[model samples]
Target: MAKTIFITGASRGFGRIWAEAFLERGDQVVVTSRKGSGLSELVEKYGSAVLPLELDITNRAACFSALEKAKSHFGRVDVVINNAAMGVVGMVEELGEQESRDIIEANLFGTLWITQAALPILRAQGSGHILQLSSALGVYTFPSVGIYSASKFAVEGFSEALSLETKDMGIHVTIVEPNGFSTDFTASTIQSKPLPAYDQVRTALYSNPAMTESDTYGDPKATAAAILKLVDATNPPLRLFLGKKALPLAKAVYQQRLASWEEWNTVAIEAHGL
Candidate 1:
């Protein structure tokens, strides 16, 4: 059965590759981005099968309207990939208040809005998949990217709860955590603020000249393939970690946290009367 997938932020990066991958597999895809021109190109190449909707996911009305349009065009939305996100690279305090808010609105709240709007259609059909494009930072914290991490962390929590909530309802939610992918991410990523105090640390940690100049990370096509597998699987996992570096980092973080908890378990268990 050919699936109809609606993907936001489809103009570029993983979103664009995912859209193409699905199209190649004979699936009808609705590609959306904030700009119409980019979406127009995909529609031109893929024809009617690729429905392009120009939208900013931050707008609630636009989000719901897109869902309605998708339903009208395809009759059913088998999968919804909320891949639209903004990366803010800077210290939280250094970043302007409004900039931080905008990041949250686009990356966190925008995903929430789209998921909420799509629930009705998915529920009506009684089965659907929701894939969230999160980051490895969602699992672990790092300096110089606090704002971006914060948004992704919120998404991680939201997706976890949503997975449990929709599990029984036949709606599957998967969170994709990708590490440094060879995409336009680094070049296109925005810095909310540049603080002199953090310059050395930022240069040492966040500034990867190789990533900026060369495509040495995981392939977006491979990531798309993983997404396809998750979408098609009868029982997909709640979280899909992507890229070579992502899983290791996530594992290390989890282990460290587990050790910390275990180290204090005696006191914790005693307090709880274990």
Candidate 2:
């Protein structure tokens, strides 16, 4: 069955690839970004099968209005893909207050607004799927992108909770954790003021040739196909990871946490009252 799909951050990266993939499969695709620059060719290629709108997910009212417009056009949205986000690179102390707040507003609050706006529509329809685009960093943190990881961490928790809450409502929620792809994410990422003291560590961490190397990046189209398969499943997982690196990284981090928890289990339990 062809679905009515709404995707954010469709101007580029995974969002653009997914939009094209869905439209190619004859699905109704409504895509949005802060600007319409990247959507023009999609509209031309797919004609009425795609609707491109300018959306800034950080604005609650704008999110609501975009969804309303989509509903008005397609009757109802069958799937909502929350893929809009930005990354900021800097150490905790090196990052300014405003930079941290801005990234949080765009990545965390933007996702929240879109999810909130779509919930009522899905509930009223009695069936829908909401796919959240998180990152492997969401499951585990790394240096130089502390704020970005924090934002995705919040997304991971929110999406997991939403999945549990909406499980019986005929609405499905899945958090997607993707590894490095051939996107210009690093180049486009916001950078905080550089500190000389941290320059050596920063270069060592971020300047590695394999970090953002395009030759080894995962395929966006394959990832998009995986997402499509997830939505079509009779019982989808609460969390879906894309790219080979995602699961290994997540599992390793989870195992480390578990090990520490068990090591201190007796002491940790003693602090709690029965």
lDDT of 1 by residue, 1-274 (tens): 9999999999888989999999988999999988765677777788989999989899999999999999999999999999988877777668888778898999999999999999999998899999998988888878778889989999999899998898888999998888777788764467765778878887777466634645447777777778888999999888877877767667888999999999998999899974
TM-score of candidate 1 versus the correct structure, residues matched by position: 0.92
In candidate 2, stretches whose alpha carbon ends up further than 4 angstroms from where it belongs are 207-216
| TM-scores for all predictions | 0.92, 0.94
With candidate 1 superimposed using the best TM-score fit, by how many Å does residue 149's alpha carbon deviate from the native?
Answer: 1.0
Root-mean-square deviation of candidate 1: 2.4
- lDDT for each residue of candidate 2 in 1-274, tens digit (9 for 90 to 100): 8899999999888898899989998999999989777899998999998989999898999999999999999999999999988888888889999879988998899999999999999999999999988888888877788899999999999988998899888999888888878786764588899889987888888787747566447877788789879878878888877888777767888899999999999998998967
Highest-scoring model, TM-score? 2
Model 2 lowest lDDT segment of ten: 208-217
- Candidate 2 shows a clash count of 0
Alpha-carbon lDDT, every model: 0.87, 0.88
